[model samples]
Target: MTEEEPRLSAREMIERLDSSLSPGRRVRAVAALLAGLAGAVFVAALWWTEPGPLPGRTHLAFALFTVFCLAWSGYGGWLLTRRVPLFATDRVIAAWIGLAASLTTTTVLAVVAAQRDTGLGGTLLVGGLFAGMALVLAVRARTRRAALLRRVRELTGQEDR
Candidate 1:
């Protein structure tokens, strides 16, 4: 009834995105899937290899990484459901990249800690990596989003009409 009301439901949102995807978007999705699969494989390998006893700090780092991934994934899913224009294909690709980076960092730190028997160093490494990755991703996303908004404004003129 309102001019600003959303016309799509959650399922419809996903369907619309899938239907309107460009070739580039499709490629990005495929790349994200591959990256996620690789991450999963790496995690599984870590478990299977049983590198050895881990330090308490490494365990803490793993837990933090798990929590971060869960939170960010949920946020991404919410954005997808809402069908926010700002959450474009590029943003999704970035999210996947961030996820992969976090996973890989956590896994590597855990393995290194186990192998070297140095929990504290592994924990610090994982924490520092997570913080750095998050900051970088946030800045990149914000920059891209700002550029997108500027482009939209240029195309549509002012919204004061």
Candidate 2:
């Protein structure tokens, strides 16, 4: 492992230098891209095709939903086009963003259900599932980021409390 001695074989070096994502990540990227794009388009179409003018709150809700879907599409497209792997910091940020989106969407849905005198229980149940998943992802992402930071500190011999 000395500087004078080669550490990686030719194939290993080439693989490390390759820019493409792994198969699983590629699948995720494509799924995210398609799902987000479809969701955005559907929401936008519904909003546009409504027969009557909506209230200010309804308009805002539609806009928010559209933006959320667009954000996901943009993130997927960015990941697909990037040359480098997503780093720990990026993952942490993404996880937090997801958590926020989940919470916001859940709250909005719950409010709408209550206002419409619909099945609030069903709405909360579904929204809670998504929010819980997002929370789990956020926690996992933070843990992973911390572990990576600790490993880097160990390798550099610069441990800090």
Candidate 3:
């Protein structure tokens, strides 16, 4: 009599899905927490230290930064937890490009505002926060992809070849 291969139980399937989703979800959660904390800190520091009144332009810039951070962190967290394929190569690349542009433009604007009055530390703090988030997302996506590919290869008995 021929032996049949054992089938995966439902629990095993669920576990696999959880494993695939966990890394990305963790990354997103961390990113969100960092962003929120950083945003609060930036606002507090700006309120305390900035000499002159906050310029309208600076306020606008801060608003933009706040929106971007909240959107990215919230959406990214949702996508990761749901195991959505939102981080395809093209999408990831596009996101990184956007991050770069936002960071650069915000920094420039902040610097200009600071030159007008020496007390705006908000820009530096927020920039660092976003930079850290970008780094975390990039690393998590890359690692997850690599691990998935490796698992596929192992399952197919193609790794050594």
Candidate 4:
């Protein structure tokens, strides 16, 4: 086995490769775009699924949950396919995403707990798990972003920049 050469940055690494992005790359990108659309459609399709009638509030809660999920998914897909660089680095953006997911999950779970006949312990347990994971992710993201910025400063010799 051989170790790959280290490049300064991802862009540099891509430039150094100088290979065609044929076959899977474009297909994969388009697929990614379509996947988001498909996800929204799939979520929307749930409305059509039926075994029997649902209580109005129960159905409304589920609908709100679905909308929130779709919006988050759509935002994620946009981030993935966006050509222009965002103001924040990927890790920072990821931290924001972690926050969004955590808030959404906690809220949705709480709504479900209130609307449905689910056990309190189970709902709290799952909601806690989601919150805990989000906390860990946010902490890790901050650490990584700081490290990355430090490295960039060291490499460029521009500490104040």
Best prediction by lDDT: 2
Per-model lDDT: 0.57, 0.80, 0.60, 0.61
Give the lDDT of residue 151 in candidate 1: 57
TM-score to native of every candidate shown: 0.43, 0.76, 0.42, 0.57
TM accuracy, model 1: 0.43
Model 1 lDDT per residue over 102-150, tens place: 6666666766677778895758676677857766776777777777666
Clash statistics: count for each candidate: 0, 0, 0, 0
For model 2, how does the per-residue alpha-carbon lDDT over 65-115 read when each residue is reduced to its tens digit?
A: 888888878777877898853446556766776888888888988998999
Off by over 4 Å in 3: 6-19, 22-25, 33-53, 84-94, 97-161
Error of 1 at 107 (Å): 13
lDDT of 4 by residue, 1-161 (tens): 89997657644533354343345544544564565567667766776684589778657755765665565555556555655433235445556655676677677677767777677677778778877887787888778777766765665566555
lDDT-better candidate, 1 vs 4: 4
Q: List residue ranges in candidate 4 displaced over 4 A.
A: 1-35, 48-88, 115-117
Which residue runs does candidate 2 get wrong by more than 4 Å?
Answer: 1-4, 7-19, 158-161
